[model samples]
Target: MESERYIRQTILKDFGLKSQKKLTKARVLVIGVGGLGIPVLQYLNAMGVGTIGLIDNDVVSLNNLHRQVLFSEKDINKTKISVAIKKLKKQNSTSKLIGYKLYLSKKNALSIIEKYDLIVDASDNFPTRYLVNDACVILGKPFVYGALHSFEGYVSVFNHKDGPTYRCLFPNPPKSEEIPNCNEQGVLGVIPGIIGNIQALEVVKVIAGIGSPLSGELLIFNGLEQEYHKFKINSLSKNKKIEELKDTYELECSFDNSSISSDAFKELLNSSTEIQLVDVRTTEEYNDYHLKQATHLPLKSIYLNHNSLDFEKTIYFICQSGVRSLEALRFLKKEQPEATLISINGGLNEFRNYDAKH
Candidate 1:
């Protein structure tokens, strides 16, 4: 009976009935239901993970359907957790799937994370990623982390028996604009598919104590070049102490203050003001469908093309998500301190939602 359930995986010499049983007994928490979270959650459920918790505050969107396979066009505007729970339950009725439809914040991070055997950081932003890591560290729970850029992806396991935390690798977050998010730069749908599936595999390894987990090692994949590289994460600081998980985690991820909510800027957009609406997303994103009258100046070009902006107008930056637009706002502020600028709270996601409702 067991062999038939995990027939393919159990065939491997290292992963037999014993490992499969371990998988069934494990409880996993997947944070985020986006590109990475979808595959991770799918495989875990199929593998018969006894219980799984999914946390996401986002709703399904047309853009997410390309990569987030668990969702369909009909799922548009539905909460990610609700959709995931419904689909995953159909995939494996035996597994208990719980959905948390809220963003993971420091306030409830520890309590929510403490119950799970493992935490998967499929979160896109730095703030939440670091928050997950610090919470896992504090709770002594192992977590698998995966991040993707345009064509590249990184995967690592943190807070394992002796593994390094996310802080050890990225001791400080880079300047907001220095690193572009997947929204601004654009990601091949398959990139996260490849990386997130790998993360799910790693989670199985950790649970079964079978194959060597990615502990103390970082795996990097370049989809464009089809090259794979593994770097030894220095374990020299393994004994280092973890004191607190706070907004400081934001510093490590290089998040800037300029990132604001679209709700906060909605009033600004409605005012009888000649505001310069800047689309920091790529041309492809802008062409697909963007705010009316928004200028298509990609974030990467903003630094060198600051003169293109009309300082006289109230400048408002926007991106697929708020991340890149915030970076654009930062760049503008540095060049023209006197210029007034603001970032749409949730960027295009919020704008599109508001448009749909109205």
Candidate 2:
């Protein structure tokens, strides 16, 4: 390790050379390289974390630029893992940066996480959060968790030294309709940075055995009002009883069987030219461009105006990406259980890509 590079940190009273050495020996695996993961990786790598692993299958898009500040218009369409690793290497050549260009699924979570000293749950979705929790509990590892929603964000360290796991805080995932992701709801570009930095600090504390980690306590930050709150998370024996990862981490909100690929969706359009299709995006997004013959309705409008929609017909939903469309499908499933609803997987982006290839 370059002692001069981290001299500022090494000179701290409690966090002296010993802590610096601990950081150099630590291996941390970050689950995503988007808005939150970028900051975590940057800080950890700069501070001399020995091995940093990032796993993500997503490609950079125009929308991602607003919050995932690491990527620019030039980097759009590039794989996030590759782009992040390339930039991070330039930031710190000494830190061993590893990139996994794939989504974290039940099949791979355990095998990958077992190799790391600590895991950083920088993922945006709930299923991944639960998967990280269960895997960490099973492998006897600790993980730092961070999440963002609009102007507010949450941070906590789970499964550290027999501490409370994420399941202890949330025993069950919320119903699909109860919570909307940042993609659907929207978030300030800076919120994830604030939350991510806190997560990185927690990771450092846990690794170096210095300050108190956020284990057994959840930190809530509201950027709008600039308020911070902490809630105690009581450990539950049942949560720590995981013997293995679940067969699948897709939550109740998932639209696996009910989702159609962009190519299949095109075939359906060709077969039935008059098929019902709805585009659930903001008015501005819909106004900018939309699929031909698609009815425009924002996500909240779908929830509020469900009575007007024809439940008798099989309705196909589309969004800028597929996120909001999935939310739309989930909402309608509860309101009209018998209604045949399908979300266009990968949404407009995938549809355009399909059009480009053909």
Candidate 3:
């Protein structure tokens, strides 16, 4: 038998053959292969969890190498799930690794997650978090939740034996503008590793039933201070039950016209050309390289300066990859629906790519 591979852990009084058998039969689905997901994948695989499913559609970038330990410069531009699989496979072949190039969507989430016994919320966005929580609640499956921003990271177990759900912590999704995500705020490379390891540890504990899980508690780690704090999340039964999955996720529900391709946006730029461009990226990003005549209005200050936006020209909002731009678009559309609106597809990434080719 492969018991030799787990001999060290099996020798522990609490985590012996019974726990190892539970781990060998357990099925875990990790939601993202980004910063948090990669580390989570490595540990889960090393622990010999049976049937680990990796779902991610994003590509590996040069910038991701610092924190996404499974990826390297050679893996740049490759699909993150694919790159992560190669590394996880090499780590341990005993664990059955399944790779899905698809992203988590409301339509398929229930079906995709139904097969797994546990869910790992390694996602970077809020809508996906809600989706996972709802799915877990609906299926009576527990989930390990991890999140990071700057030097801060959070880990929590939601819907574990009816303990507490994510909504118990935050009743509703914050207004898109109020939450500027890790992309806009930026994160130190090592923050996710710390939180992800916690998530991985929680997964092992929950699956093997070995220790006291953070069922109703949230663990916050400050890398700068190297301090850890645990806080209780009260059960909010008002919104706990989910009868049916919503057709739309709130992240994209507000902004239908989020972004367009660089080529199409370029055509809009040169022809008919009454575009009023606003870069929603930070000032530092704008100073680095930006469209020659575009105004540098960061997402944080957009609300304060929105009144000054030109109503006459067709507005084209730009950001790193149009995420912030779409957030801004939602705000602007609600504020100034009378104005013509458009978003640079792919944002500055497209702009740089076009410039490089031309």
Q: Which residue runs of candidate 1 sit more than 4 Å off their true CA positions?
A: 1-3, 236-240, 247-358
Q: All candidates' lDDT scores?
A: 0.83, 0.87, 0.83
lDDT of 1 by residue, 36-144 (tens): 9999999999998899999999999999988999999999999998888989899988898988989887667998998899999999887788788778888889999
What would the TM-scores of all predictions be? 0.70, 0.72, 0.71
Give me the candidate number with maximum TM-score. Answer: 2
Clashes of each: 6, 0, 1
Give the alpha carbon lDDT tens digit for every residue of 1-358 in model 3: 5888889999999899999889889999999998899889889999889999989999998888888888889988999888888888888988899888998977689999999999999998887988898888888889999999799999999888869998898766654566678889988888998899999999999999978999999999989999999999888776568777653455332334344556656755565445678888887888878886578789999977777688776677888887888789888888888876767657777776554211
Evaluate model 1: give its lDDT.
0.83
lDDT by residue (tens digit), candidate 2, 249-280: 55334545467767657766665677788999
Error of 3 at 92 (Å): 1.1
Cand. 2 Cα-lDDT: 0.87
True-structure Cα RMSD, model 1: 11.3
Off by over 4 Å in 2: 255-358
